[model samples]
Target: MSEAFEQYERKYCELSANLSKKCTSASLLDGEQKKQKLSEIKSGIDEAESMIRKMDLEARSLQPNVKAVLLAKLREYKSDLNNLKSGIKQITSNSLNAAARDELLESGMADTMTVSADQRSRLMASTEKLNKSSDRIRQGRKAMLETEELGVSLLQDLHQQRQSLLHADDTLHGVDDNLGRSRRIMTNMSRRMNRNKCMIGSIIVVLIVAISLILYFKLSK
Candidate 1:
């Protein structure tokens, strides 16, 4: 049991370190690269989590004393895993937000902050749901042991969700980039039209002044 605990601790530490490194390094990549790396990291984390869970179940099925110590260690590892995963999610989200901003910038779209109230509301609602889900997972860890199928299903669902978000984000950024280019072209065209209008106005004013002078001279003569 001691040997098993030691092995678990070592593996948990390795996974934690890997997760931390991935999270810290995420900010260094571009949007596409960020998305790719984050997906890979998430997959790795899921594998590590599954391993830890299996180890925990095996340890908990032992003698009472061994079970108690193993359970405590498992709890510690689970807590650390949760924290690391949360950090990874946050970093990934921040990367996506930054990518959105970059798309806005590249598109020459001014007032990126002018998001609709409805969009803002939806974002807030999503955030609340995420928080609630996190809390529920934390509370349900003990009971989650028996429901291994649930965990598997949950992972599949989450994988699908993440992939959907990635696709949506990429699509949105592409639209934003196109829109930005259009906005810049329109602005240039508008400036040119304004300049042409001014030139035409100046020409018309000069002709009127010349005609008035000629008429005045003829009348005076």
Candidate 2:
């Protein structure tokens, strides 16, 4: 019975020592290992608490001499486990606060520059005005390009119309030359007809005079 109590006491002391070491070295562990170590520590704490309760009941049922020794060992075990738990709580709390501070520093939240509300408002208004000006400039450039395209199209149309007008003027000059040649041809034809008519009339008059001379001679004979 004494040997069993000694073994139980030694086992409890060994677990207490391991729990202390785990808590103290928690800061050196990486994220996943730290979490796993914490889980194991929590399980150890629960088992220790349960064992202390069982030992208390067992100690009460034992004889006075054995009960006294068992109670003393049980008290020591419970005290050591409680102290280990307190240390673990303090370490975890400190670690959490340190991590929070580091996160704030890394995100620039802790070292952010303070700006006055008036200055912020003025900056926003200036940005909006710049955007509006840029939009207007873009629209103006687009309108100018469209005007240039329309001017080019108008110039091209004027050039085409001028070419058509030039071609029409050339055609009209050719028609005028043809009309003048036709008029001269008609004038020459009329002059030739008048000369033929005068020649025929002269011949008829000569024949009539000759015939009258002949008729007079015959009558006298």
Candidate 3:
């Protein structure tokens, strides 16, 4: 658990212990003394509830592995707090009814006011939770949109690269065709040169033979 969460938990435990002692003490006292003790208990309960809220937020901020454990612990504490609150309410009702007949009207009015205050506190807590949830939803949506845009950009770049590769392939094929034509032309030229050389050799041989025969005839005459 985080340091902050531990601190809050420690503080809440102290407050709960103190409040329980005060509640037991209040049961034995009467009149003004009892009223004072109950008032202190109410204040203590409020402080403890605030500490629980802080602990819950800290637990949520923890690493996931520890966060689940802390959250579960917080839930147990909240349940205990609720049970404590119920006990307080029961104590208050008992004390209110134990009052003298003349004070009945005033005690009833006080109980109604206390109930209203509790309702308001619960409503405020609910509103805070709703706001936190809404913020988380908004953040998640924004992250998703950014991821989607990144995916689209990558796809577009891939398409462009594929087109470039296709163009290069076409260029290579054109180069290969030109090279093939050049090779065929060179082969034909070599063949024609060989044929011309053979014809030239035959003509030279014929000239030599005719010249030799003419010389012999002239000598004989």
- The 10-residue segment of model 3 with minimum total lDDT is 129-138
TM-score of each: 0.47, 0.44, 0.49
lDDT of 1 by residue, 48-118 (tens): 78768777777877877456656765775677677667766666666666667667767977464653343
Best-performing candidate as measured by TM-score: 3
Clashes of 3: 0
lDDT of 2 by residue, 1-221 (tens): 34555455556656665666676556445356767887888888887776677667767777775576556556556656666676556545545654675577678766424323433453444345434433443454455446546655766797899999999999999999999999999999999899888998888888888888888888889
Question: Candidate 1's C-alpha lDDT?
Answer: 0.69
**Error of model 1, residue 13, in angstroms:** 1.8
* CA-lDDT, candidates in order: 0.69, 0.64, 0.70
Better model by lDDT: candidate 1 vs candidate 2 = 1
Which residue runs does candidate 1 get wrong by more than 4 Å?
2-5, 111-221
Candidate 3 per-residue lDDT, tens place, 1-221, comes to 37888799779878866766676566555578878888998999899899998988898887675676566667666766665676567556656655642264466644656654654554454345434433443454455446546655766797899999999999999999999999999999999999999999999999999999999899999
* Per-candidate RMSD, Å: 33.5, 40.6, 15.8
Backbone clashes under 3 angstroms, per model: 1, 0, 0
lDDT of 1 at 136: 53
At residue 39, candidate 2 shows an lDDT of 82
